[model samples]
Target: MKPELLPLLTCPSCRDGDLTLEAQEEDALGVKTGRLACPTCRTVFPIADYVPSFLPEESGGERWREAWSYKWENVAEQVRYSPEGDEDFERKLNFGNHFSGDFRGKWVLDAGCGSGQDAARMASRGATVVGVDQSRGVYLAQRYNQDTPHADRLHFVRADLFHLPFRPEIFDAIYSNGVLHHTPDTRRAFDAIAPLLKRGGLIGVWVYDRTQYWRLFETFWRPVLSRLPRPALSAFLHAVNRPWHWIYRYRTLMMDKVNPWPESSVARHLADLFSGGQLLYLLTDYHLHLAHRVEDPFIRHHHAFDAYSPTFAWGHDESELFEWFKAQKISVTAISPVRTGLIGVKD
Candidate 1:
């Protein structure tokens, strides 16, 4: 961690004054290794690989941390070699669509930054970004941005959303995409982060929408899949994708109503032969799995694991989110065209 970041940080345990740095190793660049000791509690937090670990002893569950850590560790390679066209452009566009404010010279907080891709994007645009996450993904994020020209403007901290280590109202803007819903209580998580934004500063978040399709998956499949052993669950998901792709490729036959069900004795056989039983997995794996429509298998697996691995994945409609922001005294600024992305200005 850089010495400049010391002023913004506080003790998460006591919310006290700035932590006193006890540098174990230092370089011309800054503190390469150290321990931050809180003045009040005297609790020491380790700073390794230039990322501060602010998580408590038993913060993120083992499986939760492992799943995300593994995903971020490998995602860079998957994004680099995959046939998917320009993941960076997609990320930039997604950020632009949700976050309306000018980022130039802004101090932004990327709450729950997964791999620091978005944080790097913001830093590249002249914004100083503090990217925080609860998992070892903070290491991936720090490594991803360490060599960039914007390295000076980018910072990574391992911390929980519910218990951020920064002083209140320190950020000019905050953007958290596809993050809060994965927390145990999405509403409480929003409340926790809202106070960190300065008055009139923008706060944007994109979460899973409670559509009819997601409702079914959440009620039935997610509960079971989230509990399964990671390896077995991943393998099962990968195995299911094969037939899902086959069905997606031959969806025309199903739409054409070839050998309509119940009327014909050979309906099942026809469906399997022509559409590859598309109806059986249409909502769960075809339509809901947006990657099925794309050509990249790595992207497919990335999206699949992202959707299924998390222990707490909730879905909310526009009204619930809008109400939450309104209760926080934040004025609604914009809701994305998809209605899943919300941006608000703090009052």
Candidate 2:
């Protein structure tokens, strides 16, 4: 953790006291190991692997954190964004219209930063980014970005979104993608982060689109999968691996019967082969099991783990999200092409 960020932190325990750092180790990167002491509350937060961790204790059988932590743990490769993915990110956040893209002198916050890939990408754009996640995934993200070109610009913390350890209205911008829906109350989660953004700061989020055909199926199957013993879950993932891919590859066609892209002769032929298996289509998305798809050491498991593993996976429409921004006094700026995500600027 950087000493520069010490003042931005407050005690999650008391929600008001400023934290003092006691660095036990330091390196060229920053404080490598330390403890953050909150004088008023007498609470302590630890810094390790270049991150100050404040993860709330897991209780009430909340296993989503474990699922994401497992994802980073098992993904042997540092997550990469293909060129297309970079473009997709731009579109998801409506960059040209909302953000200058050159983030010099900006303080950005990445809520639910997994593996810190986007944080690194943002830092490379010259923004100083704070990546926070409730899971141990923040540690993985912090360690992964330590050797990155703009490593100094990336800081990480492990804390529940509901109890982020920061003062109000400090960040210049904030984004949470494919994350808010995972919380127990997606809107409340949004409420938690809204206060952190400075007025006029841009904020963006992508939630699961309620239009997806699989929401109901996922709601039913998630409990079974999430509660499974680790070994059984692995077996379950293996069992569905092939069909899962089958669905992913065909999800586009499965989503719309009238879209012409799926009307090609070859696509029709493939569709015919699986005409009787609509059930398989809704069961896909395995998040990360990597390096084992037909024996590729790095083949990632399905995003299905992402879908069904979390205890809360809410879906919402654009208007609903717009109301969230309205209540927060933010102006809706842009919605992604897919309508599942949108960006807003604080008024």
Candidate 3:
């Protein structure tokens, strides 16, 4: 990692000891292989493939981490922001109004940064970004963004959100999107990351909106689905098909299976472009909600698995999110009208 980031790194175990980096391999990109040792707790975090992993082997192999690690690696290619454009990131972050699209000369933390997509986006805009995830997604993300224009400014670390390795008030801004809810306690997860932001720094977060009608259905199905082998479960998600889905004719399950995105591209894109935020959960089995929205049937399957396989999927209303900001002494500035997107500044 960058030498500047070394001083900011603390021991996740002790939360008091500063980490010392011993690089075995180095490049212009930064530390390629190293060991970050904590003198106080004697916790040794390993750096490999240009990414430091604070997650132990046992934790990496846990049920939930396995699911998420698979989830991200599956969609790593599809989720890459096209130079053409990707509006979802802007929509999620409320880009221009909250803090503007420009992030030059800022230090940002992407808490639970799955696949490191958002972190790369911030880095592209000139923010020095540190992305942390407790799963193997960190390695996948490192590989995904390694050759990008802003790779130098991006750092991915595998660490528990509950026990993040950083000094207090180290980040100019912090964001957790569609992540905190998966933790045991959403509020506790928020509390853990809130202290990382500098005073007056902006924090943007998006949690699941409790309004998804299929919430009960998903809750009941997860346990049954999660029990199957991940490969088996993934295969099952890909096989789900409903021919009589779209109102417009000509694009059917068989058509998508043969050739993805391009054949049914026009109408599907139009439908999703207007489908609003809760597009992933409109129908009983997500046959309609995610049909036109996601790029192809492949991505839809991943989204299905992402929604169904998570151990904890808590949904919260705006007031509950507001409470998170209020408790942390953060002032809510701009909130997304569509869902539970909260943009606020620490007081």
lDDT of 3 by residue, 202-289 (tens): 9999888888655656666777876887777776665553332233224444445654456346665554435432232322135343
- Top model by lDDT, which number? 3
RMSD of each: 5.0, 4.8, 6.6
| Selected candidate, larger TM-score, 1 vs 3 | 1
The lDDT for every candidate, in the order shown, is: 0.74, 0.74, 0.74
Return the TM-score for each candidate structure: 0.84, 0.84, 0.83
lDDT of 1 by residue, 68-184 (tens): 776677643465333343353244225455443457777899888877777887787788999999878788777766778999998899988887899999999988877888888
Which regions of candidate 3 fall more than 4 Å away from where they truly are? 56-61, 75-85, 241-290
Task: Give the residue spans of candidate 1 off by over 4 A.
Answer: 74-77, 80-101, 253-289
How far off is residue 345 in model 2, in Å?
0.8
Off by over 4 Å in 2: 58-62, 75-88, 95-100, 242-274, 285-300
